[model samples]
Target: MEATKSADVVVVCAGLVEMAEVEGVDRDTLSLTPGHDELIKRVAAAHKKVAVVLSNGAPVSMPWLADVSAVLEGYLGGQAGAGGLADLLTGKVTPSGKLAETFPLSLEDTSAKPYPGGPLVVEYRESLYVGYRYYDTAKIDVLFPFGYGLSYTKFEYRDLSLKQTGDKVTVSFKVKNSGAVAGKEIAQVYVRDVESTWFRPEKELKGFAKVDLQPGEEKEVSVELGTRAFAYYDTGSKDWVVEAGEFEILVGASSQDIRLKASHKLAGQGIVSAADKAKLASYYNVTPTTEFTLSAFEALLGRPVPANIQPGKGQFTMNTPLSDMTDSFMGRQMNKVMQNEIAKMIKGREDTPTGLTMRTMAKEMPLRSIAMGGGSLNLSKLKAILLMINGHTFQGIKALLGKK
Candidate 1:
């Protein structure tokens, strides 16, 4: 409050912590550290010239984005990060890097719906439609799209052309540094099947090239697209297929920022074996926005998802999650007793976030994790627990007694 009135510019820093972004654990929200958003809101409210610097590894929801002047995504930039940031902020070096992934408006907007699908099981429901593919196809608004970047200079795109001769394809365009500065611009080329028999992304990145330009300098750039660039794998034929269609070539700075485009009609046909067609037809038509159902996924797996099936006695195996180990009376009792033991271990901190997380993990953990974590489970004890869940309670108790 005291500094805002006197300060010329306010620089607020925000990002995710190690706990929020780790290998095994999944973040509940894309929001930057809980209070960082509010802190930025306050700072932006205090001053009009507010800039934000982000240091997180992944996408973070930024509700206060419009309120701030500038945002620098300084993502986990190693040891010399501070010095490089200084160069960028002071204009000693023009920032020319582009975003590798899309930043969604919220965690819910991401393609991976119901994220952290499981501790023991994970399903790639989105399949091929991930990142920009999902956002562009679904027409969902994003915070920042993939390949998005802003530099010291502005660039213009013109004279885009596309040529296709059977298996060979070429895309050419011109990019000019319209702004009064020298900078490098990355030209991205994406291919779209204007019409297709199977569900596919609106456009796929085929090729890209970086060009250095001076003020008013325009350079022609060409990117070649091979057969693989415009093809999708057909399980029926067990090969890549380029179905007869009109393919659109799009050139842009980012996935959303299309500057130029041209279309070329391709004459190609694919053969689908009847057997594979029967097996794959049901699962092959899932569009970018469509929900990947259990039935569809099962069709792909050629069987029912084991996780979806209710675990019964003789079914609660080592791979089964602890949450599913409650079918029989004996199984329920054993699960209850083990849960009580976990509760006692985390009793004092039960109300805390860490404790809650631990509890959730314990519930989600597979029986194998107990053996690995030394959580009072050895091979013999595990065998006994399996026996208890699998309806041999008397035998399981006998094994427990004889276990060294």
Candidate 2:
């Protein structure tokens, strides 16, 4: 502490728990390990020139961020990590990497908690609200957010414009390096459905452009969006579909740091089938037993259901058989049409049902095993296991594992 107080700069090297992603091991908290946090705090108190260098693969809560003079996220940078960091510190190289995830203010502020629950099953309760999506939508505060990064220089965004041509929307903007040092700036473009039939996140990243600029230099950045950019994955149709509505275009350096905005209207492809549309209506309203009625469904679908059909007394649930809803000739024909459409959607997606089943099993079995106390099966551990199973010598395996 005394040396830190006297030193010109105190560079604190810290990281997350080493057991991250290992079997039967998960971080107990988002904060830095107990001793590390205290050490950084104490050093920051004693020294005005305190810089923290983090070697974590994931975001960590930084309570003392305001107290530190600077922060460098090294991110488990292999053998050459130290040299690269040294270059960054000495002003030999400018840092350009951006955060791929958000850092919550508190662990509780995250979307899902009690993670890795149960020995045999871990439910993904937070469907689409994963990282920045949750924080941005819920208006939750965070220490840092996705796409956040700092360079030795500064950049300014201006001249925002949007244009639509047949199914494609193009966003164009200008980025200028306003600082003395030359560096790169990543301009991110996000889209939000102004009004949607199905629930949607506030805004989603659709495109980005990275531009390197010299001091006082400016460049025009343009990002194009296709159908998928404005579309949502509709499980009912087993296809991506864009609904007719207004969509807001957001440009930002980070998710929370939105700088420019524009709006566009989509005419919509109107490609969803009537049966699938009915299925969506039923799934969203009837099955959940909400106050939503057939009329509302009709309004959404832009058509009415068959006149002969009648929902039975009481609210319908998924358990209610299709036959119970109606027995008329039209109803039976609609069912057959739906069945054929579903078959068509499923066909050609996979060559064989066996291949599809095996692929799904291969993807899910590992998660199940990991939840059931079978060791973690991540890429790193898988590589290690492969080295061992291939009968390679220990030294050879170690050499292969060495930093690139």
Candidate 3:
């Protein structure tokens, strides 16, 4: 292959294999070893620029950081990894790689909790906070925190704007790739709520955008902020509540390395209670949900009972005792007619049993007549239909007719 032949030197970043020196070494002077240093040493001895292409299946322990000139974390590279690495090695493709997983200085400093030996009842003692949140909040040091990635070229971020438009907030910024090589940069957006009782990380990653740039090219990126993003999970209320206060929007390369930062407040109605029925009531119109329920049935008339309803059970009858003909006409007649038609349709079919259809029959049936009648069913009409259906006297048929 021309790729392998053209490269002056090839350094593969085969990640950390053995954390401890197995049976050969004792416990006292046990020092963890990095995996990439040997490859770097080999390539450096041969006098090459050194593409330390890091490839790993899972997170590896990078004990040594300063040895390698360039580091690329290639975890579980897909079908294109081999060829992609070859191109990057030969300088055919600019290395747009970055650290996917944070490289901790030591295993002890890592936020990774010790796994239980056996599969007993293991609890997530870490609670809601994990990864960089754990390290950032606990003040623990990490080799590289979350959202840490690298590009072939260097980038500079400037002009961060966090402005409120009505209820929502918009964040915008400019990124210019300053390095000579072309690369793809990821602009990470994080939010920090200063005043909150709940346990929270120093900052939380909210949104991200991947940007590609030619050498020295710059572009502006904008992101919109929704209310849910800025709020905290309140244990007392059992909901995400945005407390009335100032929230900071941090734009950066990683969770810890913030490049540009700005703050904004949630204006308008202030803090809305999760249990506030009045707030929820504001979302609906003058017509109650009963109107929507009725509209669904109104549209179902003359259509197929839609396989959802049972043939005989698709009717609605008067709920109360009917005092006069007017009550019977509206309540009983409407229910009986619809049921009679559905029953006929069910009897016509042989293979599909009527029993399975009965459970959901009423719900699935075309209840347009009842839905259009514009009010709740009276009690009399309900009893009459139940009595007829229970009595096994097809007299419930009258309820569906004589209305319109």
Q: What is the TM-score of each candidate against the true structure?
A: 0.80, 0.67, 0.56
1-404: candidate 2 lDDT, tens digit per residue: 87775688899999864544233334556877557889899999988899999988777888889999999999889988999999998889888778889988888777665353332334443445678877777777788898999999999999999988887888999999999999999999999988777656678999999999999999999999999998887655667888998999999999988999988888775345565556445333221122334455445444554444334423222233333324333334434543454456557644443334433333223212322334444445444333343333374257446643
Q: Which stretches of candidate 3 lie over 4 Å from their true place?
A: 1-10, 16-50, 97-100, 114-118, 267-404
Candidate 3 accuracy as lDDT: 0.56
lDDT winner between candidates 2 and 3: 2
Measured over all alpha carbons after superposition, the RMSD of each candidate to the real structure, in angstroms, is 4.4, 18.0, 20.7
Q: Which residue ranges in model 1 land beyond 4 Å of their true spot?
A: 78-80, 107-127, 163-166, 214-218, 271-307, 326-353, 374-385, 388-404
Q: Evaluated with TM-score, which candidate comes out highest?
A: 1
Lowest summed-lDDT stretch of 10 residues in model 1? Answer: 279-288
lDDT at residue 340 of model 2 (Cα atoms): 57
Please report, in order, the local distance difference test score of every candidate based on alpha carbons.
0.80, 0.70, 0.56
Among all windows of ten consecutive residues in candidate 3, which has the lowest summed lDDT?
Answer: 283-292
lDDT winner: 1
lDDT by residue for model 3 (126-223), tens: 44345676667666677777888765579999999977776677889999999998888888899987654333567888888888899999999988
